[model samples]
Target: MNNPAAPPSLLPANRRIVLSGEDALRILREIEFLLMSLNNIGRHYYPDGDDDGADAERRAQYCAETTRFIDAQQATTRLALMRRILSAQFDTTLGDDEMDDIERAVAALPLWRVPGQ
Candidate 1:
């Protein structure tokens, strides 16, 4: 499996690759979809159906695997965003002071709380 800690290498070479607020919103949406898929798959594989012992065990393992993949995806996305944001400022069309201001703003923001706990 690919390491989620590693930044994606296929990112555009341009240092100032610009992203909009829309892009940030998209990232959240993508994460939600992946998480939902993982949960749905787990529930399907381990439905409270037949009482076969072997099937039960297989489903349990599958659920764990699905959860791991979801976690890894979230980790990878965060790392990727950090790299992108740092690089974005350097390459921005915005002036140096403007870019610095943005960096400060982002830094000042509190960590996001997942909805509904």
Candidate 2:
């Protein structure tokens, strides 16, 4: 007896959000790294080095010209959200050594002060 060929199958359409504590920690760490990099970029562009009136004005204009991607309000809001999520969802002891190092970096960030510390 001849067997018929199987029909082609369609791809699955359903998606799931499988976020765990570790995933949350990694996300928070990435946000910390992003903020740190942005701060460094800002300092590089807007230096307090000695400059005359015209030079300072030129540098100011240059800084504005160069820094088009930075969104201060968005960064602030994201950082706040990251902090809140990390505190609420994840425990500090649940991470590995790499996360430990990232946690230290996150702690040292000067923008957000730890409460009751």
Best by lDDT: 1
Q: What lDDT, from 0 to 1, does candidate 2 have?
A: 0.53
Per-model TM-score, in order, reads: 0.33, 0.33
lDDT of 2 by residue, 2-112 (tens): 343432221132122245877678776767777776666555655664334336766776567445534643655666776665455433442344353225445434564
Enumerate residue pairs that collide in model 1: 16-91
TM-score for candidate 1: 0.33
lDDT (Cα atoms) of all candidates against the true structure: 0.57, 0.53
Task: Report residue 75 deviation for candidate 1 (angstroms).
Answer: 7.2
